[model samples]
Structures are given as structure tokens and as C-alpha cells.
Target: MLENIREKSQGVTAKVILGLVILTFAFAGIGSYTNSVDTSVAQVNDMKITQSDFDKAYQNQRNRMAQQFGEMFDTLSADANYMANFRSSVLENLINEKLIDFATAELAIRVSDERIKQTIREMPEFQVDGKFDNNRYLALINQAGFYQTSDFRDYLRVEMTRRQLNQALIASEFSLPYEEAQLTGLQNQKRDIRFAQISAEQFKASVEVTEQDINDYYQNNQNRFQNQEKVKVNYIALSVDDIADKVEVTAADLEQYYQQNIAKYQQNEQKRFSHILIEIGDDEAAAKAQITDILTKANSGEDFAVLAEEFSADTFSGENGGDLEWIEPGVMDDAFDEAAFALSSVGSISDVVQTDFGFHIIKLTELKPEQIKDFAEVKDEIQQLVSTQKAEDKFFELQQEMARLSFEFPDSLEDAAGAVGGKVQTSDWLTRFGNTAPFDNAKVLDAAFSDIVVKERLNSDIIEVNDSLALVLRTNEYQAANTKPLAEVSEQIKTMLIAEKATEKAQNIAQELLTAFKAGEDVTAQLAAVNASFEVKNDIARFGAELDNNIAKEAFKLPHPVEGTLSASTVTMNNGDLALLEVSAVKEGEPATNSNFAQQHSQQLAQATYKSFIDALRDQAKITRREVVQSSEQF
Candidate 1:
């Protein structure tokens, strides 16, 4: 029965189930199927975490960080402290996952194979045109480095089981009604406020700066006005694009390359099939019986598309008259793939197929045979490919020769360029932070400015700008760092001093107003004495947008006003102005009774409880970390 089911299942779905089942049992503490036992990184209870697993996980994490950080990723990755911290984090997470897996096994937590099937079917990555395409699913899994469908399925199964256990734990948490109400009220509280601004511009005209202040500032901060070191270089560049036109591809080469890579020219056979699926959940027997009856009707000459439209449970395809479009082998569950492919010809009806998705009645509607393009049809494409290959080979050969010639004659790039049949290039003077091409590369800039290249007048070693491109440079001119004379920057310093004095004057005036207001003196009357107009705002919620956002944020931070009294505070706006805020009334928000609020509150509470549960599990587990293993360069 199991063999029959396997034979009728879709290839992708079958492999998914197989992989997940393997992972499920592996995590359930079945130790008999261990891949490696000798080289363990850490041990949780009796289960050993292998060195291979740690290396793979660490490499994957580093790749992700490199992609996210771009050029800076290399700098961080090379830091000993950062790499140490990252390794520790990866190990801790691995330990935590193992503990969770152990807990699930102890509590008998299990995820059904049917659930795994549904997840794979619904994954957007595997879908084309809003429906699961078996060919697309197979292609993605293969491209992702999963040689066997079972391997990818194993990963998914482990994740699903962990999620199932976590959800079960979350469901056990409960939040009290009073607690929810209090949180709701706090989140929605509002304040009624009034404020007056103390503008820096009001005092700017009164502030003054002397020549003495400018001279003093320039004298004390000489380092701030220095010229950066600069260098100009004579270099030789070797790139694939430069060599492409010179590298010739003959007709014989194109034919030979096409014959060598024949598989690349062939298309996979495909078939179009319609199916009516009876999804199996808890009541598998009932679902099976329903699918059996449907198959009987289908074999009895009933219109399959009509039956599928009326009875299929796959909502994505059922509405389209059960049309799955074109499918290739290994794209679907193994059973389904086998049964569909085994059908003798177009318009043939398949047997009732059983897979993780449940049962299906399949009818093959169209068959597309595989085809390979002849040399004549793909000659241009083959010629381009051969040319690129030849150009890349020439570039590497010239790069090596340039490196050797540059080292042999350290004084000039003339020898290197002549030896490699390339031209010598020169750049204008560029500073350390130069944004020009070639000098923009950090490695090239560092090498160009180094003492060996600049002072010793030696040719720098060949630097790889990227794959298929390299550079060798010698510094032709150099500029040493020097401080600028104070006279050149004295005016700039005088303007900065004036702005500083104006801001200080404004802050001092605002402080006096705050102190007077706290001492029962009327701040509004005081502002009127200075001919300043105060702005008044009302009914400001914690998140209100109309008021100056800085003032609103500070107003919310202040303590609520006492009964029949106001709370006063000062806030500095972004534009160098200060505001003296007088919050006259505080209104407590009413607790929300809406369904959205309740649902969100429940989710937050459950997450908190789940975290606590995981923490408890960690604290209770007997975790043993092996001796620290230094990260290998291989990763």
C-alpha cells in the first residue's frame, strides 16, 4: 500500500514528505540514524551536535552578513572580537534549538505529514501564476543546493515541528482583563498643553564675537584644518572586457562547445494535468473514501474538469476547472509525479493517487516532448559563450605576467604593460578619501599610499579589483599632511562662535522663565514683557502630529498634572529654539473594548509567556559546551 502510494505521488511532494519524516524522527531522539558521532562540537543530553553542522550554519550566517553589509562586511568579519561574538551567538542558538527539539519529543509534540504537504504547496517561491508548478518547485530546490528533494523537506519539517510546539506553549498563556485594560489606557492617554517659544534669532542680533575669539579657537584646534595625504599613481589594468575583442572564437570552437554542453540545450518533457484533491486532515479515512468515489466517477466517463470544478478541495486550482497547466517531472509530490508521467498518452485518466496532500484523481490533458536545439539555432549564443571564456582565460594569463613583470622591474609600470600588451594608465592627485574610479577601491588606495609604494618607489603587488580584473600601481607623486594657516579659517571660526553665543543666550532666557514659572510667577506675563507671543495648543494625544513633535514628545514624558494644578517643563526644538511648556490638564484614556485590541493584546501576552517558557527550559537543561573551537578560514 505504501509503495503504491509512493508510485502515485508527485515527485516534489513525495521527497518533501520523505525529508520531513526523516527530520521529524531525527529530532524526536531516534539516535540510530546519526550522520557523524566522532567530531561533536557540543552535546545536549545524549545527542551530539556535529562539527559539520556548526560549520555549515556559521558559513550560512557569514554569507548573509556579507550580503547585508556590502563592503563593510569584510571589515567586521575580519575583527576578532566580532567573529568571536558571532560564533558564540550561533552556538547558543543551536543549543536552544536542540533544547526545544528535546522538549517537543518529551511532550510528544508531532506535526502531521499532511501539514508539511500543504505548506510546500502554498509556498510562494514554488508557485507560478498563483498556482504550484511542479517544475518550478523542483528547479528552485535544486538551485538552492538541495540535490535530493528529501533534504529540503527535512529542513521544512524541523521548522514546522518547532513552530507547532511553540504555538502549543503560547496557547497555554492567559492574560487578565484588568491587566489588558490598564495597558490599553496607558497606550491611548492624552494631554492638554500650552507652550511659548524662546527663539534663538531673538538674541542673535545682541550676540558679538571678537577677533581674539577666532584666533584663540584656530590656535587651539589646528589639527581640524589640515590637508589629507594624497598620491598619484602609474598603473597597468587587465580586465576581461578589454581582452574580449582581441580574443577570437572560430566556427569549430562553437560547434565543439555546443557538443560538450549538450544538456544545457535540451528542454525537459512536460505534461498538463487536471486533478480533484480530497485533502486529508484528522479524518483521513473519510477523505480517502470521498477521493475513491470521485476516481470511480472519473473512470466511468464523467467529465473530469466538471467533477474537479465541483469537488476539488485545492482552491487555487479548483476554480480554474482543475487546470494545473504544464508540469515537469519531480516538480510535485512523488506519487502524483509518477502516476501522471506513467499515463500512456494525452487524455488518459490516472489511478487515484495518494500523497501527503491527500488523495487526487488525475487526468493527463496535454504532453510536451523534450527538444534540443541544433548548432545552427544556437550558434550566436555558443559563440558569445566561447568568446567570454577565451577572454577570461587571456585576462588571467596577462594578470599573472603583469604581476611578475611589475615585481621584476619595481621602478615603472612600462615594463609590465609592454610585457602584457596593455597600456600604462595615470591618475590625477587623489586624497585618502578620494571617490574617483580605481582610487575608490579601498585595497588599491591603501596599497598606493603605503610606504613601500610611495617612499621606496616600488611597484605595488597586483590587486584584484574583482573577478576577471586586476591592477598593479606605482606612486608617481605624493603629498604629505600639513595644517592650514589660522588666517585662512579665522572668519569661519568667528561665525561659529557667534552662533554658540546666541544659542547659550536663548537657553539661559528659557531657563529663567522655567524657574520663575515654578516659583508661582506668571510666565505669560513675563513673555509679554519681552514682546514675545506664546503659542497655545490643546487636546494633544500622546501621538498627536499637529503640535511641534519635539514638544509633544517632551510633554508626554512629563508627570501628569496634579488636580487643579499644571505641570511645567522646557524642551529644545531642532531649530535651536526652546519652548516652555505648561500642561494644564491630563486626561486618562478609556480602556479599549474593540476586537482588534483584544486580539493584539492576547498575541503580546502569549509571546511573553512563550519566551518565559523557553527561558525556563534553558535554565533547567544540562547544557555542556565543548572546548572553544577557533573558526576555520574555510568558512
Candidate 2:
């Protein structure tokens, strides 16, 4: 069954799957390990899976579900049975990853350092303008919580090794010609079908929906017609941007701010240089001789750019005359930076300078000296900075005051707004599924309908609308959830009850027609008596979309009829209409000769084979689970 499903999932590589897993867990801080918590959740062979790992994985899964389901995610997250099943699935995936890691290590599967470096260089996150940027690469690693480049490289190496192992296993799978032929036939099989719909509308006139029936239905299903709880709120919002224009800064403040944030204003010195390199791979003496010969040519007044373009081994920069373009301090290797920066004048060349990459003959071409802008020159920029800082400070202070005043008053936002020198804003009637401006915010809606604010009529705690904006709201007008009066909903209930009865009648008529059709009796007269007509769709494939989907599905499920006979069944559609279906002829598909069919068949077989192999590996492994503590808190 697993193999059959895999057969349909073509072009899904193991690397793509692992990449998705990494992305899913990235939000849970999967790559960041905490040494403080050492409790084990599970052990695969000698490696122990930590409780922290399980917690992180589970939280990542929850975050994904929350993003997918939005408000409904809260309901599912609170369901104990759903949570139990979710935890089990998370732990199982973690264990499987561990098992794969252990098996790869046991088999000594390895990836080359060059492969790992290439992978990192090609990553879009670490690139700028389609070229690899060293600074961006370092920044991204740090942002992803990796303190060292080697740690990220090690993670990449593990992922690459796992992908290599999976590819090897999948490549070992093959399919027989007969199996491919059979699957091709099955994919193209066709059947000739005829169907007639007995619409609910046909029986609507006969359905008796009395006032008593309507009243009974409305009474029995009052809960379905009840209005959602609603509230109108008065809120005070504070934003940094709104307060920024009101702040003022003087000359002294500008000077003080400039001094405090000198690093942000200071520019780093830059240098432009070109070099001719001789890479020392195995024989250092040979490389030294080669660099000396190049240095002699350079000193003898030969063009440095010409020499670099011909003799430099740094291919990335060599093509551009070894132009390591304009580089700031700390951008290059330490030894290289120092040697190049030591040259004081343009056109000055260094003789046989040595670093990790090679021996280099360096020439300084241009320089830009570092400068700090004077307070008077940057006064406008300083004023903007000071104003933003002051506004943020004031916003925080006012936010705290608003929270305090709202809490003390309990029933109104008037005191809170007055304390902050802001105005109280009122919203329209807002339901759990609210509409309109402020009510559209999920946090605002959740707080508006919460028990403390809606039922007890108290001001909500400060709800953050964004990083710079927050609000405190209180319910001004509240409406309790209640069912509509029966009289108000009786007509709607009457229409619905009539539709239900009509559908029941249509289904019975369809079943009777189907029975008569199979019994070799003509049903044309019967259909005419009910004011129904037959519609025919011919040459429908097993997966064809020509006929109504429900009818097509039921027709294919019926066995092929004997010659000159028919197979009939009754099918119900989404609109409560009944379809009386008859299969007149069945045709087995011939194996397709198209290249697309060949490729699809090949992929399906490979996937099926890979799935079977993995299942076998899982079956052979000895697995165990310890008592897991499921917590509601996000890790």
C-alpha cells in the first residue's frame, strides 16, 4: 500500500524532503543546541534523543499548524486526543531522522569538503546580486544562531551525506517490463457510460412542508441558528511614529547623540589593489620561485594588471586582473589585509607576500581615508535620530501609564486615554469572526470577546498590534449569543425541510429506475411519468472528467457487464440530486507508446522500490519509546 502511494508521488527527491524538514524546524531553533537540558526522550543504538529536541520539533509542528489553520488551530491544539496523535507523529519523525543518521555513519557515507563549500556558495540566502557575498554568508549564519562557520558547514555536510545515501538506495531499485505495461494499461482504461440525473427540484412540488414541520425543525436546531457573541470596544492606541513629530531636539542633543553613536557614523578606510598569485599546493619551493620571477617582472616596470591576469591563481578575481575591487578593512584574510594595507602609496608593490591561498606580488592602486562627519554637517540626521529615540521612550512610558489607569478604572478607556493625552476610539459591533478595521486584528478580536472584557466588562491588558503600536480596549456594548425566534427563521427552515424531503423522493425514484433498468425492463416510460430525461456521456476513461464525477466514480466501481447486458447503480451528488448510472460497454486500455508514459512509469517504479527498501530498513531496526511528557507551553 505504501509502495502504491509512492508510485504516484514522482519527482519528490529525498533532498527536497529533507530541505522541507529543515525549513519546518528552522523556526523551532532546531540547529541551536542547549547543553543545560540533558534529559533523554529516546535512544537509537548509542545516540540518545534529548527531551529538548522533541520539545523543539513539537513546537515547530504546532507553529506550522497554526500558520495553516489560523483560528481553527486553537481548537485543534486544545484537543487532547489530537495533541496526543500529533506528539506521537513528531517523535516518530525525530526517531526516524536519528535512525537514518546512525545508519549513514555506520556505512561510513561521506561528502567532500569542496561539495559542502559549493552548496553554501550557491545558497540564495548567502548571495547578493547573483554573486556569492562573504559578508552576507557570515551574517546569515549568525542570524540562524550558528556562532561559527565550521558549525554550519558541519550541518551542511551531514545533510549532503544523508542525501547521497538515499540516492544510492533509490538507484538500486528497478521495475519489470510486465509491471510497467500493466500499470500503463490501467492508467488509460476507458468505459462507455450513460447516466440520468433525478434532480431534487423535480420532486419539490410533491414535498409537503407544513407550518408544524417548519416550527418543529426550527425548535430542534436552534443552536445552529444562534448569533455569535459580539462586543463594541473603546480603545486607546499609542504609536512611536505618531509621537515622533512632536519631539524636539537641540544642538547640544545632536552633539551628544553623535558622540554616543560614533560607530554608526564612522566610515571604514577602503583600499583598491591588484595582485599576482602563485598557489603553493605541494611544493613550497617551486611556488616561491614562481612568485619571485613574477615579482621581478612587476618591479622591472611590467604592467601589474597584465601580470595578475596571466599569472594569478585566484580565478574568482584573476579574470578581472586580480582586482579584489574596493575592499574595507576586515574584508579579506588577516595576513593579506595587513600586507596590502602596509603599502603607503599608489603603485607601490610588495615582493613575494605569503598567505594561506598563495604567494602574492601585491600592488596598491588607490585609497580612501576614513572620516567622521562633524556634528554641524550631520545635524539634520542627528535630529531625526534623536526624535525617533525620544518618541520610542515616550511611547513606552505612555503605554505603561495607560495600562495602569485602565486597570484602576476597570470599565472605561476614558481615564487611560486622558492619562496618555490620547483619544478613546470606538469600534462597531465585533463578533468572534469580526469584520472592519481594528476588529480585523486577531489579537484585538480575541481580547474583545474574552471573558474578562465581554462578560465581566473590564478593560483588556495592553494588546500589541505591532512592534511600535499597542492598545487597551474595554467593551462599551455587549451582546450575548442567542438563537433567533422560531417565527423569524420558520420560512428558511421550511425551504430546507422541503429540499430534504424532495431529495429523499428523488433518491427513491432513482433507485427504482436503476432496479428496473438492471431487470431488462425499459425505464423511459417511468422517467417520463416522473418528468425526468436521460443524458448520455460516452467513451469516458477511468479517470475521465466528462461525466458527473460521482456518476463516473460509481460507474467505474461497478463490474464489467456480460455481452449485451448492463451494470447499473444509483449515485447521489453534492446538491442532493440522484444520478441513475448505466455502463453499456467496457474497454481495456492498450499500453501507451508515448515517451511521457515511459518516463512516468520509470519514476513510479523507482519511487515504489525506494519506499519498499526504507520500510524494510525500519522493520529491521529495534525501536523503543519512553514515557513522553506533553506540555502545552511553546518551547
Candidate 3:
């Protein structure tokens, strides 16, 4: 899902980014590129993944990588390397996305505005501490390069469409037992091995080292010292959160605002509706007869659910006793929606109403009265609005004071402290690229390397590193280029010794256990003594499982479990846990009975159809052509 989001965000064009989709591409030239427009980077059915889309995706990818890796990434690759890799990855992803979109359009998958609102509300990035933060939410969208909510909503729409279509496709693409077996059979394979390890300590004695060697290595890596220009800018900012506490809104004002926007407080009428629907065939006469029969039964005051079961074609709703939940306007077919809403009281039944779905006889089960909430009932909302404004005003006042003091006394950090009454946090020397001491944010580190701090030895500007706070800095002194002597790092060498020894001990134990197992010794006793449970994940299928590592793939490649220990293997998990497994039992996919077969076949067929529909679109879209430059620069 994260990868899917990455792909969609990548394909966002300059126009699309600024085109009103919030949180997409930025209007500023964050990572723009110039290329010819041939309209053939990818094809989705009849649609195109235009050059603009690829460039945007590529640009966003680069920005994200730069933000993530920072200085460390500078030495990893050149511009060409980045571009080549980005092109291949983005092209494949965009192709898949466009295909799914085409399928979704054909299928007419839709998402409700309520659902989008809910998604936004649930996003953790938009939250502060533990509650939703509107300021944080807005800031993130702006940083992402989107201009407004509507644009983000459109991006969300495309995303939902892709998901729904993929789901539908998965349901349609039924894989038979034979196909499932072809994948699952691989998991039945097994192998045999005996292995051992050599630790880093083992090679420590053989390692060559000298004082000159250290000096040479350090001198050769001057690019590491080629400092990037970082700056701290003095600025004044206004935000609602800062002055919110200072603003005092009166009850009279709140009342007036409520009166002006009464619709916000007014309770909308809701309908508890039930309908007996008679589905129509293409033949008008047949539909009319079905509608007529339902209307007659309803008029006779027959139990609605009973009449629905006897005459309605909406099997799903009919089985539920013809109950439809409370609905507002615009929720149902226009004809049915109008008739349902027109009801003035409970127990009222509508005349047979014609719609695209044929005819519906609606019963008004209940009516909710409209009411305007009093000011006291919504005081908290008003308080939040007024307080937020006050907070913004107060925050910017402090910011302006800080900026002014910093400009007047450029070399003194305390000048700003006196002006804004904000505490001045000074620290010892910090590295140019590395974040340590007082600098923990990007803005702080950037300021440490600026011309004013390094050359002129002056204080920084009011730097808003993030949304909530801003800071100013003055470099007290400079540290010349130097490396710590080996004598000072001797204790560090001892710590490395302990780490290498522990790893060697673990590997030695593993090897000894593997040997014992080969001799038919009980392995459980050894593991039990170590307090580790030996897990045997049994009869695992190859596909449709959420396993990202090569382990699952390697597991399938092994032959069916035998009485012997399998290959001596080592996999270092992300968290540093390593595992060695012996295959004990294995099973493969096989055909089921007719009833099960039918159900599975139907599901797979649906999914495949959906996937095919999407793939066709991607294969035909208006994509631009270019020699995909494989480089990390295109990130």
C-alpha cells in the first residue's frame, strides 16, 4: 500500500500538483526536469502515462530520497545511476496504476465524501501528541506540494478507484488447483547443508593498520569535508495556534455567528426508510407487471418484509426485511430519494416510484425533527476558533521581536532572548553535516554551516525548523579539522571486541547444533536449554501471503521435508534476529470438491477480469516515450 501511494504521488504532474489536488506536487521548483514529450513512457489500455507524469513521479522520488538520506547519500551514486533506476521503477509502477484506473473507470467504482473525510481525520501524521492537529495537517499538505483540499481529494479518489478495481480484479482472476499447485509445490522442496562461520575478530590479527594509513584514508575523502551551505533565516510568522489563547470572543459574537451560519447548528431531518424493490428486465411490460404486483401487496398492508420476499427482486435487502437505514437527501435514486423525502410522517408509504432500478415502494419508518443548537451547546467549538486566532497573534509577535533583535545585534544570541523573552539555548561546537549537540533539526544544522556563522561569526536568523517553534543561533567558536587519535578510541576498540566475540559465540553454537542434528541428536533439547522456541511454519502456500523477504521464496525452492536437517542457513532479520530452519513437513495445493471449486473459480474469475481491465488501460494510455535513464538521481 505504501509503494502504491509512492507510485501515484510520483506520477503527479506540475499542473496536477498545482492543479488543485492538495498534498501532491508543489508549485515551486523542488525537483523539476526538462525532457521531450513523446507521449510513450507507458500505455494503459487506451490511456497514457504522459512524460509530465513520469517526470513528476521521478522528481518527487528524488526529493524524498534526498530528505531521507541527506549527506550520507552523496557518496552512494552519481546522477546517471539514480536516473536509470528511477525510470525503470517508475515506469513499471505507473503502468500498473494507469491500468487499474482504466478498469476502475469502466467499473464505475466510487468513494463517498464521508469516507475521504474519515481517512483524513484518521491520518496519524495530521495528529499532534494524540489528537488531530489541523495546523499540522495543513502544513503537511503544503510541504507535499499541494495547494488545497480539493486536489488532495481528487488524488484520494484515484487511489480509491485503483484499490476497488484491484479488489474486483482479484475476485475475478480465479486460479485453479493446478495453478495454485504450481506455486505451492515449490514450498515442498528441501535441501541439506552443514556450515560454519568466521568472525571479524578472527581477521583482526590479520588486519593491517598504521598511523600513515589512517591519515591517507582521511585525506582521500575530502568530499566528506566539502561542506554544504546551510543557513538560518530570520523571519516573522503568523499562525492561528499562537494567538488563540489571547483572543476573547464574547457570547454575543458567538450567538451572532451562529445565527449567521444557522445551518451548521440546525438538525437536518433524517428518514428511516424501507423499500420493496421490483427489479426490471429490459422488457418494459415485465417490469410493469412486477411493479404492479408489489404495489398491490403493499397497498393491502401486507407485512413489508413478507411482501418483499414474495414479490421483490432485491434479494439482499429483501432478506433483511426490506429495512434501509436512516438516509438523507441525495442518497438513493433520484425518483426514490424524492418520494422518500417527501414523506411528512412515520408509517406513510409512497406510491410506486419508478427509477433506473425499476420500481420502489418506500415506507417512512421514522422522522427526525430539525432543531437549532443553542450557543451554550457549542461553546467548545467557538472557544477553539477564538483561542486559535489568539495563539497565532501571540506567536507571530514573539517571532517578529526575535527577528528584529537578531538583525540589530547580529553577533549576540542574547539580544533576541531579551526582545522575545524566549530562552537562548547555546551549545558547544556542532559538525557541518552531522547533527549533534544543540542541532537536531534540518534547519538548525543548515544554519551551523552558513557564511555568517562560519566566516563572519554572527547569529542566525529566526529559523522555523518545523511548524510549532522557531529558533536563532550564534556560533560561539569554530573547530578546525581534526581526527581523534587511536589512543582515545582504544576503549571503543574493546567494545567492538565484545560485540564480535558475542556474534562468533552464537554462530559457533549454531554450527555445533547443525553437526549434532546430522548425527541424529535431539535438537529441541539444545534450543530448550537456550530458552528459544523452534518455530515450524507448516504447509505454507507460496503466493497470496505477505512475506517480503527472500525466505518465503527460498522456502518454496526447498524440496519436501525429509528426516534430515536441511541446508545450514542464515538470515539476519531487520531487527538483528537470525534463524536456521529444518524442513519437517510439506504439502501442496490440490483441487477441492465441486461446490468449493465453483466458489473459488467465481472469485478468481472476477479478480482476473478486473486486473485485465486495468492492464488494458495502462497498455493504451497516452504515455510519453524516453530512454529510461537508470540512476538514483531520478530517485
Candidate 4:
């Protein structure tokens, strides 16, 4: 699935930053300059996926994994083996994106700025107390590394384009009765099976192991005994904490800083304002100069909205005479905010304030009075600033001493530890290929098995798995993979068989019920007589149309649910069961009362239509992705 949100990952900061960059690229920003020119990774239509593109995507995915898994991140870095897998995934995604782009262009479908704006306005992320907050939205984008809402909206445009492309492909595709009937029988099936489950614990008393058996098992699986290659690295970590401890805040310093910016900490009845954006590109010095001329007109008393329409690059807001909904303090660039708020009354235009976007002439559309959020409220922030400066100095000093000691006792774990006065700890036994405690990091695990650790029986070189930390490892012992004897595994096999049988029986019963119904029998009555319960919930529709499963959706789509057999439809249960459904009734979804609900349903319907389109295209398309296995390791 193309997830709408970046799933929480181990290294969130890196992933989020990369995500923003990716967004930037889609908006025709500096990201394109960073694109890979290599031609081996992906084939998008006639275009090849460049190595740089693959690397960017790979880095994003790797960082996401680390963030999601946190300290227990088990995946190896861009090792030779992992790189191969990364390349394959990146190629596939690139190919898919390219295909969609081509199809969208061919269809002449374009996502307009208005659509992007509407989408942004509807996003729940920008809401405060269930209403869209202009300031909050801007703050979020800034924190996520966006320079402007324009860049973010451009990303939404690409997504919308892809979605529309998919919908166009699937519009004519519909499931027929034959398909529906098959699906219905699978869903309505019942299982009435009685079985005994004998687990491993049940036969524990009857099992016994001998040393010979253990040796034989280990000998048979010799490949599992071999260790994977690993590296040990040494490095230093620089963090905010390392520099925040030594800084000291003096009373006079705090008071002076506090007095200088007392207004910053003061809460106020902030006015809401927004502006139409006119962005100047990095290379468009000439265009920017032209923009300055337009700002001059606004400063000369011309209506800001009128001038925005004449020259603003923001097509969406410009159409509305450059009306930017509502905004609050902290919603704009520092210079722009300062000028806008400095105005004494609404409708007053301020002199030009230069920001990266271009020259801006601020119009104080509204104003609110001050409330108390005094400098004392933010005294801690000032204190931390002073403390951070001191900490930074101390950290640098400590690092210099640590570096000296590390160089003097290179490859000497005990000597280095003693020199630094830090404790030296030993890790539990870890295999190069095992995922047991304290050895999940493949690189670190490999280092423990290297010649330095194994032959010399010494601490391996300091290994850095991630940017923030480093470690040295010494292997204590090795354990090989061995299969349990058949006697020990028999109970496990039996339990699995029982579940499989039950599932199989249920499918058979479901098929029988559907068949009987088609033959004019009361299938529900038959079920009851057999002590098998059947549910006949009504008014189920497709997603967005209604909230229901595939079976329910199919039922609601049927033409004659009150009498004739329903068109069989497919339904996949949560327990991994695929069933055929026969519609019992047809009830269209109710009319939504709230705007939010209406929008939600609209989006869902659009997404469903889009997915159907893509599926159809896939069926008619011939695609071949080269399989590159750099190593035996599987993701």
C-alpha cells in the first residue's frame, strides 16, 4: 500500500528530513538537482531509474526502519546484501511511479492548485480544536523542513495526479455474477469440526535428548554454524546533550536577555491574516527583480489583492484576489510577521519586508490586543541557552582528552578504558548469524567473529552501527542452528493440521449453503437446524458508500436481494479466509449530514476508484523486474 503517512520509524529525524526533500523534488525544487543520473536501477516507461534516486529512497527506508524499531533495530545497513534488496524495491517503486505519470499525461488529467488547496484545508493535521488553524499548519510544515506551503501543496498535486490516473484505469472494471457467486460461497461457508490439539508441552514428559543427537543435528546444519561477515568501528557522537551540560546562566545575563525580548513571551489577542504567495526560484534572479517591481506598486497604495492577481505566482489564492483564509502570529516569515503586526490598524499596508520567497508588502488585515505570557514564563528557555554554551565548551575539552587517550592506546580496550576512567563491560555470547540477545546488530555480530576477535581473542575494533554510537565486541563462544528431532516436532505438526482441517471443513459448509440457496431452499433455516448460526445484516455498501466488509458490500450491490440469489462477491476475513458472497439485499448508503463526513466519504470513494483503475492496468500490462540477489539474506 502507498501509505499516506510516514509510519513511525527508528531514526525519525533523518526520515522526516528526507521525506521533506522528496516532497521538495515533487514540487520542482532543488531536489531534482540531486537526482541520480545512473541508468541501471529502475525503468520508468522509457526512462531508467538512476543510482542516486535509488540511494535516496533506500536511505529514507533505512532511516524509517531504524526509527520504527528504535534501539532494537535489527536490519543491517547498506551492506552488499541489503543494498541489492534496496535496489530492487527502489526500481519497482520508480517504475510504478513512472508508469502512473505517463498514463496521467496521456489521459490529459491535471491536478489543479485549487484541488491541492482544498485538500490541505481538509487535512486533520492542521486542525486545532477541530478547526483548521493557519498558524498551526505553517508551524508544522516549518518543523517538517518545508520552506513554504507552496512546496507542500505541490507534493499533494502529484499524489492527486497518481490517484486520478488509477481511477481512470478502473472505471469500467466490475465484478460479474460468476465472480460474485464464487466469492459468496466462500464467505457463507460453515465449519463444524471436532479435533484434538496436542501441543509440544503435552508430550514434554515423553521426549528425551542425547548428546549424540545434538551433535548429529549440528553437524547436518553446518552452514548455519558459519558466521556472517561483520566489522567493528570506532567513532564519537556529537549531540545536544553533550554541549548543554556545561553552559551556566548568570542572573544578570537572564535579566538582560529577558528585557530585550519581553514582548516575545507576552501572550496577545493575535490577529489572523494570510497572504497570496509569489515564489521566486533560486536561479530566477531576473524573475525576483521583476517581483520587486510589483511589490513597489503595492507599496504605492495599489490594492495588495489586485497586485497579487496581476503578478502572484500563487494561482490558487490569486483567483480569489489573493485571499489567504485566516492566520495568526508565527504563521509567516520573521520579517513578514514583524512588518504585518507593526501596522497600527487593519487595512494598513507596511513597507516591503524581504524574505527568501521574494519581497513582501504586508497588509494588517486585522489586529488583537496583548495578554500576559511574560518573560518569566520563558525564563527557563533563556537559562538553557546559557547552560548550552557552557556545556559546548566543556564537551569540546573532554573530546580532546578522549581523542588523545584513544590514539595512545589504539586497539587496546583495557588501556583505553583505564585512560578514560570509563567502565569496560563484556557482552553475552553472540553468534555472527544469530538474533539472540546483545547481538542483533549484524555488523557488530560479524565483528565478534572476525579474525581479530576470534584468532587473537581480543576486543574487535570499535564498530559504529549508526551515526550516534560505536562499540567493540569480543566473541565468547558460538552456537550452531539445529533442527529438533521428529519426536519433538510431532506435536507441533498435529496442532497445525487440526486448524487446517477446521478451515477446510468451514469452506465446504459455506459452499453447500450457497448451493442450497440457489436451489430454492431456505439456507438460513438449514444452518439453524444444524446448530450453525448465520447473520443477515442489511444495508452494507462499498467503503465510503457505507461501512461494511466485502461480503456486505456485495450484498448491497445486488439487484434482487429480497428474492433471487445474490451475485457472488469476494471477501477476505481478518483470519486469512477468502469467501464468496451472495447479496441478500440492496441498500444505498445514507446521505451524509456533516461536511467532514461527506469529504471523508468522497476521498474514500475516490481512492477506491483509483485502486480499481490501477488493478485493471496491471492486468493488461506486461512488466518484468530483474531479480538481483546480491546475497542470501532476505528482508
lDDT, each prediction: 0.81, 0.79, 0.61, 0.56
Best by lDDT: 1
lDDT of 1 by residue, 1-635 (tens): 33344345647888899899988897876765564446678888777777777887787887888799977876675555887888887887788899889888888887766577668878999888887777678789899888787798888888888989888877876667787789889878888888888777767687788888888888888888898778888888888988998888888899899999999898778778888999898898999899899888888889888888899998767888788887767657889999988986888888788987789988888887889998899999988899999999888888888988887667788989998888888888977552456566667877888877888878899998778678999888898898887778887787788888888887888889989888888677778755555676777887766877899898888887886555888888878788888887778988866677777778888988877877888888877887546533333
TM-score leader: 2
Residue 613 displacement in candidate 3 (angstroms): 13
- RMSD to the true structure for each prediction, in A, is 13.6, 13.0, 13.4, 14.5
What TM-score would you give candidate 3 relative to the actual structure? 0.51
> On residues 560-616, what C-alpha lDDT tens digit does candidate 3 reach at each position?
655544543444333333444454555544433355555665676785686566566
lDDT (10s digit) by residue, model 2, range 1-635: 33343344444676688778888778767545554565777876667877778888888888898899987876665455877798888888887787778778889998876567668767999777876666678878898778888899898888888788778876766656677678878777888877777788977888898888987787788887998777888888888988887887777888899899987676657578888788998999999998999888889998888888888997766888877765545555678788888988888988677887779878888887877877778888888889999999999999889888877677678888888888998888877652654555567777888878877777888987766888898888998888888878877898889899998998888888988898889999888877776777667887755666787788879989887667888899766788888887788889756667666766777778766766766787767677677542423
Encode model 4's per-residue lDDT on 2-58: one tens digit a residue. 111212333678689989978877788664575543335445446655555555666
Model 3, runs deviating above 4 Å? 1-96, 99-266, 289-293, 296-300, 372-385, 396-421, 427-467, 470-635
User: Regarding TM-score, does 2 or 4 come out ahead?
Assistant: 2
Clash count for candidate 2 is: 0
Model 4: residue 444 alpha-carbon error in angstroms: 4.1
Off by over 4 Å in 2: 1-191, 209-226, 248-267, 271-387, 433-446, 449-451, 480-493, 540-546, 555-564, 586-635
